[model samples]
Target: MSEAKGHPPVFAIHLTSSATDGTRVLAVGAEGPLSADLTDEVAELCRTADDPGRAGAVQVLPRPLRTPARVVVVGVGAADPAGWRAAGAAAVRAARSDEKLQVVVPPQTSPEAVRALAEGAWLAGYRYRDAPDGPRSAEVDLITDDAGHAPALDRARALAQAVWWARDLTNAPASIKNPPWFADQVVAEAATRPGLTVTVRGPDELAAEGFGGILAVGGGSATPPRLVELSWRPDGATRHVVLVGKGVTFDTGGISIKPRESMKLMRKDMGGAAAVLGATFAAADLGLPVRITTLAPLAENAVSGSAFRPGDVITHYDGTTSESTNSDAEGRLVLADALGYAVARLDPDVVVDVATLTGANAVALGKGMAALYSHDDDLAAALTAAGDAAGERMWRLPLPEDYLEYLHSDIADRHSSPARGAASVVAALYLREFLGDRVDRWAHLDMSAPSWADASDGDLTKGATGWGVRTLVAWLGALGR
Candidate 1:
């Protein structure tokens, strides 16, 4: 395997009036006039092409008479923000290996639409390669004269870069992404920013501080475990929000080994950690006026003699003893410890934890949507709106009081896994037990299904999709406003 950690290619975006020397991309609506540069011949070609001017449709024409050697016409059906985004992505993808592109923005497009277009273009251009000498992204020029769209374009670039950083971390091979290495990468990235202070606690510190859940889950791995705290404390910030993420670098189900097919994408088990890290980085970059603290409990649940077995009762950081009915259900174990620590020591006004916690989430919400569990109606609404705005949709699931008995343990205070079904709900209920009295201020995101994609779609690649970063960043931005 290649030692290089795959980083997404960067696209240099420019706002210009004239088309560049490379490929020219035109956005055409189903019922609108063609771009001025397009001749009568091209208009006739579009009229005859099947599904021309439909959303996400792409039609490439080799224009011998045009200044640019080739022209790509992308459909912008109804010209909405979503349509514009899809058009942008389809345009860049049609450009293929071209290193430079001039994309024509539709007339009278709003600044929000312009931002969406740029985001979709930049995100679709992302390609993660294991080799250092992999192909780079195209230099894109948004052919428009609207100077008011500058700030929106800049914001789009920042958000895209944050998502790219998250995807890079999540896509890194398990061979080089153990707990220590993960901590090192996060620390190195944080060193570049001034206000973001990072502290990493190793096995000794974790044991001494009573981080039992984290240590127990990581006991089987030779690389050990780490609890990483990243803080951004801005002056005059009234609300303090703490974000905890499960950072299982790779999971083999420990003593309860998983089937071979289920373990192939275990390298992406740390996607939640990547999402929180990306949101924090975006917050710092945007200089949001909100105090944010992020906790990532890192571990690898491998199979070994030292592995914590099923039926073992382990004490979590808050001194709550939990029976491990299934060693494979380890994400919630680490998240519980981190959430408990955050509530006890951080004095947070709000707490949100994201984790790839349960396969049952997929069963309930399919692979495209995430499972959201929160008792606070206000918090649930804010997150749902944020997710909708960011294009990472989430459906709030109930934490029923009736199902609390499913987690009952005869030998311990509570159990990690339930003997009955409703595994996703049970996992969230188990995590809620560690939140102390802050249950109303806490929200949990089970992003197990949406974290990785089976194939490349609109803004998602085949590997890590960096699901929760956008939603968290949007919500934080709203809070800052």
Candidate 2:
């Protein structure tokens, strides 16, 4: 409808047309003559182009054109469907360069598949390389079969920006992302958006509220701790969604100190928190008319004599006692406390807590996907769909009723971890206990696998991915007008 902030909507967001000037399409194909639609779109695009080269390399291009927006033909080479998706992402990046032209969508496949590629393109096209002014921005035109494309494109744009926000919040060094500092970032970021009310609960306030789990997690760190909440409510909002994110700035495994390599990526331990915060940024950005409240439980589980020991017993905010079986499991503690607080305070219609919670999840799902565990089948399916559309993979794991026995403790209400293997299952079951009997719609996401990349992949950039944000955002987007 309008340009981001400035520019007179310089490019019309359009589907692939034969014209390439003010309108252009991102094209890809097998090494053969262009398809009829592809050829026509390229021809039209070339007319708008001053240089045929910038027209956009995709399926193919015209030799010359009237205008200067050169053609860009993205080479699909010989890849299957997934290859096309990657090629589309590459096309978006290529088009963004050297000019401010609108790149059109050329979805030759299913709408969802094309949207997946577009999501990837929007994601890969991001350049967080900070300019003194900030990162450069580009305009994208989605070639769609449907008439109503602007709203969908806008939603995708919001989701992409939110992913970047999640990555930045995760990528910022531990020195820059401490608990209080993180809370401040949340306040400043959330305050800028309309209809968002920000609240910060300090350590004293947490203690007063019986948030022993959070207090225990953050007590060792010099940075103190906080619970930052961002809420958006329209009149008579139909759904209440509460998201609890683990905000451990860094994790040292506390008394159960991890190896040097394990601690290396600890700075990203709060990747889950960043995702929710980033999603909050998107929510505020899009002004989605849903009652979304995000709780970021901030902490740094450092190692000092003051650090909670492995043998220590913790009294949680819900008045449940937990015997710490392994100090590395501290993420669940902070998240448990946050979840407890969220369920108690908001009593939301649906509650979700995202965290880089367990290593077993990584072992189960690998780095490409996160494990999604929920009591509600509908919520699980919704999250799975969101993950696919957003290009984040999530596998729904069963929260078996029998698995509850592992978390039981002889001395306390629960043991911090299960006695045997399959730690991921045990971890999810442990969290289920914290939600208590009333909340039936709760789900836990173990983001350990997808949040951090071994390196950059097809569409993912190196470091923090802000994994669950898009899915959560998309699910929320589906809820309201």
Q: Pick the candidate with the highest TM-score.
A: 1
For each candidate in turn, the TM-score is 0.91, 0.80
Worst 10 residues of 2 by lDDT: 8-17
Q: Write the per-residue lDDT of candidate 1 for residues 77-134, one digit (tens) a residue.
A: 6566667777777777776463366676645668988988888888788877566797
Clashes (backbone N, CA, C under 3 Å), per candidate, total 0, 37
Would you list the C-alpha lDDT of every candidate in the order shown? 0.84, 0.72
Question: What stretches of model 2 exceed 4 Å from their correct place?
Answer: 1-71, 75-88, 93-102, 105-119, 129-132, 136-150
Output the TM-score of candidate 1: 0.91
Off by over 4 Å in 1: 1-39, 106-108, 132-136
What would the per-residue lDDT of candidate 2 be over residues 125-214, giving only the tens digit for each residue? Answer: 665644547653445655454555556556666778778777777887887779998888788777677788889999889988888888
